[model samples]
Target: TKMRSNGRIQLHSEDPHQLVFEALLNRGTPGVIAVDDFVLKDGRCDNETYGTCDFESDTCGWQLHNWERVTSQRISLPATDRSTRSPSGYFALAKAPGGRMVSPLKWYHAAKHRCLRFWFFISGTSSERLNVTSVVDEDQEKSLWYGAASEASIQQWFSASVNLPAQEKTPMVVFDAATSGNPGSAVAVDDISLGNTPCPPPGSCSFDEDTCNWYNAGDLTNAQWYRHRGATVSNLTGVQLDHTLGSKEGYYLLLDAEDTSARSLGSMQSEALTLGPAVCFRLYYVMRQNSGASLSVGFLDEHHYLDGRATTVKATTPSQWTLLQVERTELPPMFTIIITGRTEQGSSDIAIDDIDVRSGRCTTAETDPEASMPPTTEADSPATSHVTEPMPSKQPAPPEVVTWQSKTTAAPATTEPLPPVVCKRGEFKCRTENTCIPGSLLCDGVYDCLDGLDEKCESGAQCKENEFFCVTRTPSACQPRSMLCDGQEDCVGGSDEALCGACPAYFC
Candidate 1:
């Protein structure tokens, strides 16, 4: 039967090996005719119905019809003179623990397409920090999309259909370690395929799929498509890699459940930095839970970079998925973004995904044509400082007797302006007073954050004010890492000089 665009390749025969093309039902009454030489190409299936997807088809004149019959022998690959339709030719090339030779899980992307799909039989890995990744260009050095998993059980299989980029080449398949690394478990992949078909958007009147302008193609308008983590309070989805999990992508903050931090470079932002003009960006994220949410987003000027500009703050919108739309005017070209989320003080397991940056031009008012103007020369200076019609020399002697008019003006409240929390250095706002906390309150036996930000020490940097700073009190006890926890070694002689702050900044 011809494969229709929407219709799936259905296998509905009593013979198990019917889908095997050429097979010999040597042990059953309802047998199948075995065909000849055939070779399978890059294959896999991530379609949902297929359960776990993989390439299981054997391209030999001898096919499989559920151990039933052997018929015609004329459809296999150009094998050596020893072209035996034998399973012996098929051997497990690379075996990871718990790998199934039947259906090996493989991931791939199209060079220029829209969707990626596949199926695989997956076994649990022994290592928790294990994952299988889909790679493009084999930048083994670096890739963009990566993230964590949801389940732990193994053996049973599932299909996955990841959305592919509209502008990339056919990608290679990879088994990453985002989920638990079951060095002991085996994974099977099968039936690999890809295509760029028009996806009818929900409630749309447009039919033009060429540009994928399918109705809601309006950038970031669909709220349902967006995922959120009420607890993690993320603005965008983060790429999960290795085993360590939490709000990672374009977000950096401490997780309430654990003392470790996630220092995703994208989120390690600077407040007072400069950006070249024509600045803009868009970020996507998937939240794992529903809870309180508060994030931050802002640019930086050239004000403060004393220590560094590595600052991130909780920005707008919590408990909902969103594409943070950012724009800047007259910004330097190379500015950065720092987004942070701390769910109401004591929560973890937030999800994040898909972060992208785009730019556009500024209007004349925002960025005038004459970008630079020369300093005023002496020729442009006025002879007199005051504009009193040049009446400075002839000004009458106006002895002004200061008449004290004491209208009972209410004195402005003299309360000291609260210190800026400085979540994001020169860029983001100290909106939440005491958010970053002063070193004093953290360990100074004093309560600093009236809002209790002092107690909420992120990154476990709990060096309170007036505490034993490495400045004077050297370490008496010997700890491999810095016991001070100020991201610095406390040993006067640099004994505890190991990499102390190896902690990422996103996890609390």
Candidate 2:
């Protein structure tokens, strides 16, 4: 039977796989084979038909199973991949833990126009993953898509369309799904289709089959960018990696240097982009232990490094995700985003996410052009100051009678302005008040402020437990790391001498 464009037909068959094969392999009908809903059981069916969304057909080469029926009440599933098919029912993978299903592989001759489209719903946690792989040249396998389980409270079906490139040998596609042990982890798929058009770009990613956009480029041994579900440090302390909690905004990129002993550099670069004039670039970033660390981004011109400008920001612990925006007026033919992390001996992890680069002019106004003027000459002015002669006062003016204003009629009451709270050279302002406290006293387990704002600190610093911090002075110094442990009274309060034994054995 030949399928017409934008046509709908319902075939009655106990074996759904047989119908699919008849539609795909039927002679004289070189058209697309589309499946609206899982042919097995609809979502409205009773629980008795819950695990029966699969069937076998003698006409088809292989078995067709793996997906099962699920009710729409559990999830707000999409009824269609495109508007062409809708009002469909729900279907999901076998909920059994570690259970998986694979679709029958069919061979297709090499063709430039090959694409696959489908709608899928994922729930539970990050443990649940769905992957689509294809094989060409008999043994070579290529992954098309990989998605972890969703943590979102409300599960929504997402549509995906991918391109299938021609190969030297025929290609076959397979759909794979795995359960993460959660009964609520609903993994539903519907509206399978094949087409000739190319797939859309996966957000900032180059292709739907590739990994994320940001990647490590510098010395991987010293430090590297890591993908994390949340902002967290590694488990092993001896390795000296400090993990943070999640970015609170889903997936994030992290640059860690806890393991590196000496000065190291970690560079995470973004995909190459051709930027337009006056684009606003924004991203959210977090800095754990900022000491001796910095993050920067720059644009490279055609001459590699010539005519490029970079902006760098020092690390600071923000209470939550912090926004950083950069506006560039000059447009480059092409540019690569380079985010480099520099570490001096020791540093904490740095994380960034929610990167957005779009077309738009900056909000700031353009500067006025310089005014044109002639050069001034010394002849324009006299050597001595010019004075005007005061008119001779006729006799002494009559004694002026001063009128005294009444207190009630005094000018509006004005209070004296409070003095600005100036902090010491090495300290920061406390959230509680304008009070300045030593940076060392901050997060030192001691409540330096009445409100204890100074003590509110984020975990994971490079300092040792026994080390003494003298943050009140210029160039904040740490005991034992300074002149204190060498039998010299370097600190005015002798804190360096007092904490001499606290210094590490190697330092002595």
Candidate 3:
């Protein structure tokens, strides 16, 4: 089959066993065209019911155009299927000269929220790509996710979660694969599930499989968080088992001091989160005796600036994992949790696992009074402890109060002189926090201010001619028009990459 320049498909056959070849073009109505002995069915999986497919025995009601259900033993592309992790397990596979496999149409309401989670494996060349799209009315389609094999390893199976757009009509989910004619290229998908929830809840991580979106701040020159399962390479101080599973099989984020010089600091930041009234952050950590490492947690505004004093742990305990909880009543609306690990002389390792963020204040028994102590004014603190200088202010000064609790003595609050803040022109000053960000970053779908004041623009606000407004996101956002169809989801609803032209136009 060949795709013509006029956007029509031409089918040809020369085999003697093939007697006839017929072509029919429906000019008016749009529909699926079946050839040979193939047939198309509704294969409905309703919206109210949970939809899932392991692909163990069959396609599980999905309509295959060029995709096929095969076992890993039969195809050497993916070494093992994610569902069963065995060679005999079945999975959907697509090869070169690619086509699409689509799910049955399901009724979706405009108000309902759902997420599609799946594990996909891609191996071979960079020319192979997979796209997940939502199609409605047989023509209109929105890209949910698209990527090439270059972003992942050949044998590793990566998990993905995409939020399905809410549409009033019946929409079919499509998995379209396009590949170069290289025989080495292939794509595999398995363990697909659709649930009525968000893809990932904010600030929750176990590090059992992936980093859960937590990323290194890249501030330290030689130190960063490493995901490890068993003991450290040095086998000198790190935890032998993870806190989550209490075994060597489970993974945790470890900061090994053996790889870096003494006093090196490393930090990891979580994804952005919106905090409610009272919030509690909890995690499990291990700090061995003579480790000479201090662990601290702090808040970073959306612009990646540290907001307030961090909760630091100075003393080391036994090799066992310890639970720590920090509860705060006053916090920025949009902030990210930053965990910093600093190594002093003789430091060995510091590991953390099972970080969680939730609503409501922590119980009295769980809250530690020492956790609320102000950060030390030591010069060797992590870079995240230093807040950006604030812009110059002419407003009236208010009395600042500082208070602390001690078992031996009670101290009264004392007023101190406020430091002058200065910011360059075209920078927006955060009202509650002493930080400044570029004015252009305001109303850009990201919360650049600690108090979220930068995102307070009215809906459908006007943008420059070279900008595209993201109407689907709350408060809307303006982004550069060049981001459209860039194979990256810049807008909240993926509007930036949706409705792109077919790939065959360029690759063919």
Candidate 4:
């Protein structure tokens, strides 16, 4: 008997002869092959039926090599499954000494593409990495995504979305976790699903995937904005987690005042954006009490010049994230958003996240009416300043202002003549006082000058042969050449420790 393309069995006989066939029946079949009575439509498998997995009760048909179903109590890390967000929830976990976990092969077809969405938790050193890949063929695999947890993300779960392009053949999805053999390190994933829908559109940014076209204005000030995850390096200053994810695993734009001089300003400029008749800009910010930090949002023209007045806000609630919305009308065709942060030698840091821009006036439900900007004629308070221009025939609400105290005061007049001091080639003159100090004392991480002038090294400033100049940092910085590659970041920009040779595995 031969099988035909139509799946029918036909008997072929070259010599025609009388043939008698007897059917044999037995109470128990010795060997039998069973086939599922289902046909795949268009040779495509439903992702909801084949690709979705929660790992709550079991591995959900996924083959696990080194991974196992685990609960929060079983893991040393303080993380809950994304599915339930509860300690009792279960998730697939791969501990240090890891390998690959794979899903069953399936053929997927969609109008556009399939999106794989999952929540992952990684708690380990930099050497530990978790990668998601799809095996297209016997020897071909395409990487979907890969990431490693930082020191602050050990307790937080992060979400990931990957687009799976249409393939000619069925593919097996694989989760490969690698480690540096640290017994405490681990990688966890839960609540995975594949669907035909594309990933949601990201607005301006949540600061979770880089600054999103926003860049630090290098010439603004010595204080620089850093893209950071988890709590800042300083103590009792910045937020412990980002607002978007409410987890340390998320990213935010931070302006740390701890490492910068007093009254330092840090500015971030957005890419040029088109504006409609009316626009609303929104963002989330945190400024701790006594942070001495003030935030301002304003517009800039295409030429990078300020187009209008900036709306500044001060810290009100300590260590709490506040929502800020600014509504503008009669805006230029194209403009950029300028976010500036200023610190007055305070201990707290300023952070902002989840910036969004949209057309039309900010709705009342989305803004705090009580916190709206007051009229320009409102007298300035000691701890806050409310400034706005007179409205035209069409009232355009000014940006909401949360302001801080201005500690600056006019200097008293002095009649006495001061003596002038001249410094030698190897000496440095103080900017605020008539004093000179040796050039070697500059940027020593200490304030040797009365006004800290010796510590403020300008960009392109000449340094001694034995000094290492940190050219990347604003206002620059200098350190002893011997301190280069010492593993410690003495420069604000970490230029001192950059380009250092990699450390040995054991030492890392």
Best by lDDT: 3
Error of 2 at 33 (Å): 47
Better of 2 and 4 by lDDT: 4
Residue 314 lDDT in model 4? 75
> TM-scores across all candidates?
0.24, 0.31, 0.41, 0.37
Across 62-167, the per-residue lDDT of candidate 2 in tens digits comes to: 2225555444544443333222233443344445454444433443345554545555666665556676676665577767655544322234444455557666
lDDT of 3 by residue, 1-508 (tens): 1101111112333554433446664444222334444332344333244366777756666888888889878866777787667798888988567889898554334355565667787765556778888787666887766656554422445555566655577578898887775655678889777755443344666776556556665322436687888887665565788867778999888877564422256677765555544667777777766456777776754334345446677545666566655666666655667787776535567778878766566654433322222223344233323211111111122112100100111121254234324333234567788765554455567876778977775532577768865533211246677966776544433445534664422235
Q: Write the per-residue lDDT of candidate 4 for residues 212-288, one digit (tens) a residue.
A: 44666532224668778787767455578777777889887888766443226776776545554466777777777
RMSD of 1: 26.1
TM-score of 2: 0.31
Candidate 1 stretches greater than 4 Å from native: 1-112, 115-278, 282-293, 298-338, 345-356, 360-508
- Candidate closer to the true structure by TM-score (higher is better), 1 or 4: 4
- C-alpha-based local distance difference test score of model 3: 0.58
* Model 1: per-residue Cα lDDT over 1-508, one tens digit each: 0001222232334554524333444342222233345333333323433332222223111121121111113212111111122333221112322221211222332444343333333333222222233344546422222211112121222233334444354444343332232343433333333435322111111111111111100011111111212233232323242111223222212223221222111122321122245544333332324434333333422211111111122322333333333444455423334344343323333333333322343212221121111122223122111111110111122111100010111222445343223232112122255243212123234454455533342322444333322211112111223244454333332222222444324224
Clashing pairs in 3: 291-347, 390-421, 390-422, 391-421, 391-423, 392-421, 392-422
Segments of candidate 2 deviating more than 4 angstroms? 1-211, 234-249, 261-263, 317-319, 344-346, 362-508
Residue 450 of model 3 has an lDDT of 72
- Candidate achieving higher TM-score, 3 or 4: 3
True-structure lDDT of candidate 2 = 0.42
